[model samples]
Target: MAVRMEELRDHEAVRAVNRAAFGGGHGETVAELVAALRRDDPGALSLVAEEDGEVVGHIMFSRTLLDAPRELVPVQTLSPLGILPQWQGRGLGTALIRAGLDEMGERGVPLVFLEGDPRYYSRSGFEPAAGLGFRKPSLRIPDAAFQVFRLPAYETWMTGTLVYSDTFWRYDCVGLR
Candidate 1:
């Protein structure tokens, strides 16, 4: 029931949790992307929820960008937030998200964005990004699925196309068009 950030040594367990949580190619993508992000940005955080020695949930926040009308601004993105099927509905995922967002906010991250189920993310203060002047690169994303959350005072920084890390492009989450 306790959730906290995992150290680098616990990396494999985090991948295993992602594998079980998403159950497909997405898991593989999660594992690969996690590794690349850590290698590229040691400042990135990979979080997990551990219960009785097992990792039941996982989430990641790393450097990303907002491509505004004429320039790119640094931002951090929330991605691959997953709770193992057996652990779903227990609120571990929500706790992981709240913790990650709070940690980022306290550290002065101006904004955070994600692509996820609106019904779920909305409860955590996320609203459709397009409503905030942001756009998803892929049209496959439903309007309701792309969302952003900015501290009330920093909402101005959330606009424009989200540019994920190069790993995203390598894996086709970006530059796919």
Candidate 2:
């Protein structure tokens, strides 16, 4: 499978993948959130995993902010990574993530944060954000779920609270309920 930047033509496939990956009501919620993010966050980084011209997976990274002491540091947040149910365990998710991170790194994004399974995300170079002196935007986020990947552009001074975009709150996706 090849991972690449998502194009306008892949929107429906991306939505279908998200819905299939999450399933039921939760899938619908994620699908809606992704649509809203696409419309609201202009800086969102969206990637798709395609095989034989068929899009089977999707991932998104949105620009967020770090409330640092000196200034608000612009950062990226990875969320709602989805692979079609049949595509799970094929490493498409990892490929999309690595591609997204590489793309962000090329753009000089210092840090990428996400709320996910530590065991899974750690393989992609993500560590607990708290360990790096960054606070979660919500108390609802579990310690392990709040993870970060420091890119080459990252600086020690960038550590602080990660402020997610308003769309996340509007979707009630800040963290576990």
Candidate 3:
């Protein structure tokens, strides 16, 4: 099957993919965030994986700000990468991740942050943010689960408590921790 990056249409179909992928909790809100980001910040990267006119997977990157020692710095956030259960082992998630990173890299996005499985995200070059002076704003989150990927090199410039957009807070991403 071919994987391509394109603007996501068919809101209901995207929602269905999310519902099926996450069993009503995660997917539904992730789908909604995708639409909301598109409406509010159309430039935010929203990509979908389609095969035979059906969306099998989705990944979202949105604007996020880092609270640096001096001031708030803008960065892209990679989150909520969801793939339908049936497509779990097919490497669609990896492809979407690569596409997202490549797109961000080309744009010179300084950093990308995510909260996910260390074992899996490590393969994509993510490391614990705290190790590089970045700390999670929420003391509740374990330091290990919060990770960052700096394009050129990890440095003090990227250190800060990550501030995600409001849409992410609307959903319960407990599974992320």
Pick by lDDT: which candidate is best?
A: 2
lDDT of each residue in 1-177, candidate 1, tens digit only: 887888877788888887878678877877787778788878887788989988888888988888887677777888878888988998998899999998888878877888888999999998888988898866777778888888533656447888777777776654213
Better candidate number, 2 or 3, judged by lDDT: 2
Better of 2 and 3 by TM-score: 2
Q: Candidate 1 regions off by >4 Å?
A: 152-158, 174-177
Off by over 4 Å in 3: 8-10, 153-155, 172-177
Model 3 worst lDDT window (10 residues): 168-177
**Of the candidates numbered 1 and 3, which has the greater TM-score value?**
1
Clashes of each: 0, 0, 0
Q: How many angstroms is residue 132 displaced in model 1 relative to the true structure, after the best TM-score fit? A: 1.2
Candidate order (TM-score)? 2, 1, 3
Residue range 87-165, candidate 2, lDDT tens digits:
7898998899999999999999999999999999999999999988999999999999999999999988988899998
- Whichever of 1 and 3 has more lDDT, that candidate is 1
How high a TM-score does candidate 1 get? 0.90
lDDT order, best first, reads 2, 1, 3
Clashing pairs in 2: none
Error of 2 at 46 (Å): 0.6
- Give the TM-scores of the predictions, in the order they appear: 0.90, 0.97, 0.87
